[model samples]
Target: MKIGIEAQRIFRANKHGMDFVVLETIRELQKIDQKNEYYIFVSPGEDKCLEESKNFHIIEINCPTYPLWEQIAFPRIVSKVKLDLLHCTSNTAPLYCKVPLILTLHDIIFLEPKQNDNKSWYQNMGRFYRRIIVPRILPHCKKIITVSYFERNRIQQTLQLPEEQIIAIYNGYSKHFKKIKEPREITSKYIQAKEYLFFLGNTDPKKNTPRTLKAYSLYLKYSDKKLPLLIADLKEDIINDILRKQKIEEIKPYLFYPGYIPNKDLPYLYNGAFAFLYTSLRESFGIPMLEAMACGTPVITSNTSAMPEIAGEGGILITPTSEEEIANIILELEKNSNFYQQQVAYGLQRVQNFSWKNTAQSLLNLYRQTVTS
Candidate 1:
């Protein structure tokens, strides 16, 4: 079978969750399948991460805008390739592709009820694009894939699709995520402190950055240890704004902005951290939670959405909306060594359940089934 996978942003220097998922899945596919011909579609990027094997081909499609790239340039390329099936790794897909579609709808957070008032032009445009494209493309897609069972149910109910139509395939962390032998070498470059809580945050409203800062402030107020927080992928100005808005500017000294850390160095950061904090209001699957766990680091995530489902009994789960609850968890983890070690042990065991090899096998099966049908 000739398969086309839309991994538009895979080669980009700064990649997010969906990009990593597609890249890892493709790499695993290269390892597992030797007979099926595969084409990976991507935009021009600085990072040439994936190397083409005998069965796999990397095709770069360039255009000025995202809409034009996906809608016009992408489909034109797809038509020429004449693939048996095209898997749109990202949520949105070309509306008019002739090939059968398999969409990985990571989440329906945009369709969810408004929880925060944070908005950016880039975010708004992306949301608008998904809003217009998802519903239109659903009918045409042969199968729909999501990252978690929680999101599968939400998509099924909201889009009114059958349970069988939308299947949940959980995301997996890279095998590189493991305990770092020399964590101090990496940690020293980011912060002066030997130990600090770590968080991966951005301007995305669902990340609950403001509330996290508030929680961190409350933790500092009550706890005597007062561990600093090292936040990645967020600008200092944005962090300051959040701190000011939340009226927790006093905790500024305890906050460290590490700018953006590369994917290669993340395992070291996780290993060195006192604890990994992820209190998103909603998520389809919390990849960072598992990444931290894979590094044998204890995690503090929210109780809502797929957090509990992904974290299981491994990480400390708290109410994302409550600053006090998050603060209390921080205190508990710091004060109680037995509880902290238990979480760390559980996380190490839990991470073994997920892997890119397993995810790729599931996707490969689905592709075969879809093409034969």
Candidate 2:
């Protein structure tokens, strides 16, 4: 079977969730099915990750990604590729690709009414498109793929699509995420992180950054503990200003804003953190939760979305609105070392279930089914 994958987001000119997912999925697909040929359709400025694969070929569609480009030009490229099936990992696939289409809608956070990081207009526009436009286009596809059962259900209900059409493909942590030898010098550089709680993800509304900060503030109120609160850096300057405004003298020193920690350095951060805090309101699949757990770090995340399914019995689940409740859980984890160790053990055990190899195999089957049907 010959499949075409919309690979415009691969490596993304910068490392991010969509980039990681696309890169890892393609690499795993190459390992799993050597016979099936894949045409990765990358955008003008995008780079290919499958250069070494014999069965994988790069089809450079030198066009922009959105608006007029996607609506007007992408369908022509799909027909030109002579693809049996096309898998779109990005949101809003071409309105009418020539072949059968399979789309991966990571999350419907954009569908919600709220906005964060001053992206109100973009989010509102996307929400409108997802509700009004996607339904008409989706029925033209053979199947749909989502990162979690939560997102699968959301897609089905929102689009009024069939349950069977949406397949839940659980996200997997990279093998490189496992605990590695920490360089003594690197460890010494961030000595302040000894008892810090690490928060990943960009500081956006969907990520629930304000709620996380509120919870951290509550944690400081009653506890004698002075553990630092380390926030991963944001790409937006406005977000930085917002973060700085929240930084009062009491918690200012505890706030570590390390900008764009490389993937190589993340495992060490995970291993070193007191507990990984994931306060996101929604996630198609919480990859950071998986990464932290795989690294044998204890976790605390909201009970909603795919968090409960990912965290299993490993982490503490708190209500996002309750700052006091979030703080109490942090206190519990800190005060009772036994509880912390237990959470770590459970996290490591739960993380054993996800594998990129299995995810890719299922995807391969879907491609073959679309082609042979």
Please give the lDDT score at residue 136 for candidate 2: 67
Alpha carbon lDDT of each predicted model:
0.91, 0.76
Off by over 4 Å in 1: none
Per candidate, the number of residue pairs that clash is 0, 0
Q: Which prediction has the highest TM-score against the true structure?
A: 1
Provide the lowest-lDDT 10-residue window in model 2: 183-192
Task: Estimate, for each residue in 159-238, the C-alpha lDDT of model 1 and write its tens digit.
Answer: 89977888999889899998878888877888888889999998888899899999999999899889999999899899
Candidate 1, after superposition: displacement of residue 195 in Å? 0.5
Model 2 regions more than 4 Å off? 44-49, 115-133, 183-192, 235-249
lDDT of 1 at 40: 96
**Could you tell me how far off, in angstroms, the CA of residue 168 lies in candidate 2 after the best superposition?**
1.3
Q: What is the per-residue lDDT of model 2 for residues 120-188, given as tens digits with 9 covering 90 to 100?
A: 575456577766656567787788888888888888898788888888888777898886555334544
TM-score of each: 0.98, 0.90
TM-score of candidate 2 relative to the true fold: 0.90
